[model samples]
Target: MSNFVFVLDTNKQPLDPIHPGQARRLLSSKKAAVYRRYPFTIILKHLSLEPNSTPSQIKIDPGAKVTGLALLQGDKVIWGAELTHRGFAIRDALLTRGSFRRGRRSRKTRYRQARFLNRTRPQGWLPPSLLSRVENILTWVKRLIKFCPVSSIVSELVRFNTQLMQDPTRQKEGYQQGTLYQYEVREYVLEKWGRKCAYCGVKNVPLEVEHIHPRSRGGSNRPSNLTLACVPCNQAKGNQDIRDFLSSKPDLLKRILSQAKRPLADAAAVNSTRYALLNALKKLGLPVTTGTGGQTKYNRAVQGVSKTHWHDAALVGETPQLQFLTNNPLLITAKGHGVRQRVITDKYGLPKQHRGRFKLSHGFKTGDIVKASIPKGKYAGHYDGLRIAIRTKPSFALYPKNGGKQFDTHCKYLNTIHKADGFAFSFVGGDSSSA
Candidate 1:
């Protein structure tokens, strides 16, 4: 057009009315310009303060929130920090040091300051609450009606609870906080459940936690977040809400939500997820002949089904293996692991703990080495090891620690030269080997 110079599209979303995407510059420097002022700024949380910064740093604090500004920059981060005030030499150094020391607690201070100092702006095209409702409606409608109503090719619908992400800590694990809807659902269940198992009245057994809101429909994992479920009840309940879990019953979702308790409503939510499995031996679905109740080897049957059922597993005859960053960070999820654990062995222990799923956050080349530490136990000291590829199914691959596989249960889990600290390992070289 005219003589306007162009460089790159800097995301200029405002931090407040004074500034949008220019938070770093506006907050740090006065000369920086902001187009808007007095805006309703969202307080973003860092999903993970300690993210996959570098291939060397795998398995960060896991507790650190990743919903901060300086996020998704990958691991090569200096830190999500800024230098506020400085006198000259002495004052500057002190300010820098203080920034590093505040830790997670400082995030609260940032929130207080932002809320008090920043001006709230009026909604333009969309209000956050309305937008969130739209998202919920779309999600439910898609499930009930199928397909999102009115869509753009570039529009990407993220998970629910996007607003909670402003806080950096919860950001890392995907803004996974319990919501008001979830709380309402839980309260409804407890009210209906008379404080004990409906069928057995046994209160001591570790209760199974479930959601009236199906996990597939953006449900989250939390306490007011869940309902009491016994193994026997759960097996019968499956994935469907309570009514669907039982036949000839009406859908309870609405009554459950409105009745304010999970159990009492005639059509309220209950469990009805189907656990379907067929033995290769019987067309009528003959149960296995191996385990206590004639079930196939636990791991073999559920190897790829920790997240889902065997019929829904990725592979037909084989198990799906955990993907790694080449030989870097191991993919891990915080739920239902037994379904996957049975794959390593055929033993079927009682389903006791919460499910743990495998998750691979990032990938690395063969040459990229990751620095990891022993999570717990005797191997408290850190060491180093080479990475060797552990090939499972041709389609699935994972790289176990090279040199010696110490993390293995078969005694190799220990190191020869034990240091007071835990062990370290790398992808390629760069101090990736134990001397």
Candidate 2:
């Protein structure tokens, strides 16, 4: 199976997506023409389409990091993408800017009026780091709607509960007590060790309930002494005290003991912005349905499908089964518009150089998808969404879509395929032709 081919009528009105084979036939028979490259959309040349179309649903698996998206018609998944966010990049950029500003102000400059508490955030204001996530998702959804008749949306609002998973007995014993009785020993141990082997830090492996103190040496089975460790680590540390075993790695031992006393702190920060995402989705005016990580996991398990973002997305919503899904879905990285207009600065917060005001050069800009055919040159081949830097006159520095070595290419040899849509494209699981 492959991604659903986006369809459009002669008037450019949205229509239900068709199979790749059907799209191929239409292209071969000259009934349709390729409209977009990344999503593989086609527009009808002459055929009149009805206003009514099949109801298509967009499923989203929102996460603190990578987000999963899928477009489904009936039980068939037509399009899927794993949207990688640059929230951390945005945060780092802001931090660098702040550091530079602070450094500049501290160096023999007249004191300015304090701006603290003067600037007020408007209602529903979100930090740029968080807002970037919401905007990225919205951008894709809007683009999809322009090509396909999307009727509804389903999104995963929250991940599975850590406490419930760590201690299953809590379901019956209530919040205060569980099977172990003393402060939910298993849950504490799992959280304290971060559900991974304490020594190796290997996760997703079967972890054995371990004792920091050797039981044979009078180590109690209390929650304070319990920790999670992989089978290999447990065997290696058999009958040995934790401090003695980790004597060579003093820092690791200190970190483990220090973290054990504190609860997980990052979860709250990750989840705080999700409600704002949900609200943004609702503004699209579609009937939005929400699910939890537990439900998504259950659905995926029942379907016997391998774990992937697309599979998780297909399993979302009220759909009973997924009749078809692409063996290789497109992997899209949301590289925001290459429009940084700041002057380059040195390490000491001094301006090193000024950037050019003009964005266009030789009738093309960076992030533009282009095809180049140079008969005799080092940079000779087809390229898509290659980021370019116009340093010289005829030749420009070209960076490959996928991370690799960059080279210079002539402007005359390059043909613009698509204007940059504020995204960088790459294929995952298989070749681009499979999509």
Candidate 3:
């Protein structure tokens, strides 16, 4: 067979803490933008499991471990490996440069035109025009900071738009980044609890996701069957009398009873691309800021007028109306950081957990930890009235933050000891019984 090798940069540490397939995952992450700290020379190996030695012997692909060789070449190979499989994508894989042009039919142009067209009449969007004209008109006259000049602004604006307009091609790669996303999910699982059985809370960073219901026995990636477990845990829970993975961990089962049990707060930011937008904005030399999103403005006149007139209505010149960077750019959450609050309640409104017994949608097992909230009663201070519970969810869902810390309205129910007023009970099955 044949092999492919790579010489990676010496800077980046092991990103995911796992061994094999590290390079594929790393390069797949943060696409197009290279991680300067970590670089690598990939080695691809073309091999056949059955050595029939003929033209029709066989051909291999990415998922086939036997067909690929993922090596950690700090300097030399600890174990012998010559070839690597075709694991596409790298941190620095540049998008083929093209003339970025603005056409009447393009999405950016459509939004800009729509914004300008929408201005013909107000959609009751402007809260109080009378108040706006009164306050903003006066504000604009008093504070006139000296930028280079409008001529300079106009010139720069022209240059930027000209550059943006250079790209004319309209072909969608549709960007099938699933392979990369798959790698990320694997890394997240391994890094969270090592290689131990997730149900039993055993650490085995090297463990793989064992199907509690193996495909051979009729299982899909529906989540319940898929669990993090060592090779041995997987083997032990084989087909014969395979019970649910949750039965293994007492802590995970208990989270349901110990939790505040309320709705979630606003959305959190987690995707790596928003960070890309943040960085790109800074590199463009704008007084870049992190934020969720806000009402979009277009007119060269109104947009300019709004920022100059109002503080909250920020001014983004003729640069990239970067709304395209995000999937849901229209729903602007906040200006600085796109943090969303779910449902915040005053302490007076919070519900008290029943002291004696409580039940959860899920049950409590072992290896559970109880987290409590600081009660508002006499023991509120110094965690005196603190009550703990186990987590019930298999895995919690959290959004990524654009900047600072993003707190949710519903977050009072999670990652905290508190819960909403209507919510009763105090138990979480995850790591709580053990906690």
Candidate 4:
């Protein structure tokens, strides 16, 4: 089913979200007008007699890369959205800018006086990349509150409990003793290797903890040095180095080594921001509820719902028998409203093109979603996409949503659908749960 439509009163107060069919009828009967295209909102022509709406709760499943949001009314999920953050993109941009500045410093500012290290960060400082994830989630939560009668918040606070695992900071003597240690290591390895034999990539078999570097050869009992292997594979590679065991399969050997060295960056990012997100939600004055990843998984499995970010969100905390009102979720990617740099430069810091002070041209700004109708040309047809760039001339560059080649379309043929909001929106998975 399609997502429910957000509705607003004539006074601009948020009303209860209604089904898409009801919204379509209201629009067709001239009782309501389109208020927002991205969220599919409508405004009533008359003020709502009952401005106070039935209290709905906002459920969130915050992740490292994407955060899922769902609007729950009673036991039914009315609207859903998956927000994709630009953490890596932000980091890359900052790195590029730093490189440019460093190059200039080395080339011409060698004699410049060094600056004092006087900068002090406040308590609870986060890197810009990680901070952006929290901000993106908060932005959407506030926006959803403005469009729905959100009275409470529910969030998945912990993806996995690090306390249950081995603490790298602890001394070897401080490690948990006996079965607890074995349990922690086994659980961690199962998750890391997908509960399969890491050597043969075989699943649904009895697997044993195998060492990458054999214990007899001075290998440490660190989690990174451990992997899963079936009985035969374990026996075959017993007391042998992983390199020697997988000598014939160089590619698999390399992959295993690389994966073993891979740090839990994604998990760390989520853990770092969980408390910040919780604090932000509490500041909203709503009764915030929290759940763990295990609880969410159980809730979803009990209901037989397909695994997806939004689905997990809808089943986050103390969930009842859920009735899904929508299978399609609005996909939102955080494409920050262009950059502040006026001049576009190349790798060597040479200016290539300068941006106009004013982005508007022919009554349209860059990033505005538009529908273009071409009467006749190489690209002669109706197209729907974003206006990536605007020209002083009549023609503008249009990037099609359906992966078509970006072509310039005249101002007369373009109709604005949605204004630039630093986000690109689309819908996916109407008949299924994978959105």
Candidate achieving the largest lDDT: 4
Clashing pairs in 4: none
RMSD of each: 26.0, 5.2, 27.3, 4.6
Better of 2 and 3 by TM-score: 2
TM-score of each: 0.17, 0.82, 0.23, 0.83
| Clash number for each model | 84, 1, 110, 0
lDDT tens digits, residues 207-247, model 3?
77665557887665532234576677667767643435446
Best by TM-score: 4
Residue 93, candidate 4: C-alpha displacement in angstroms: 1.6
**Residue range 1-435, candidate 1, lDDT tens digits:** 001011111242212111233444433564343221111122222222322211111011100111010111122211111111111233343454445444424544332222354676663323331222222222222221111111111011111223253455655334443333333334345445544554345686766556645576665564333556677876676666554653453434443344333334211111110011111112222221211100112222444322121111111111234221112111111111112332231122123454324322123222222233445665444444332222221111212354344332212232222111111222223323311
Look at candidate 3 and tell me the lDDT of residue 58.
8
Error of 2 at 149 (Å): 1.4
Question: Clash pairs of candidate 2?
Answer: 4-78
Residue 183 Cα positional deviation in candidate 4, in Å, after optimal superposition: 12
Q: Candidate 1: lDDT of 130?
A: 25
Candidate achieving higher TM-score, 3 or 4: 4
lDDT of 2 by residue, 1-435 (tens): 778788888888988888799999999999999888877789999866456589999998775567788988788787888877777788888998888778768785664534787788898888888888888888888888889888998987755343454556665336334332432355346645778898999999998888888889997665557788999999999998888999999999998777665654334434666678788889999988877665677677778987777788777756687875576677767677764757888888787998877667888876677777766766666665566666647787776644568788888878777777766666674332111
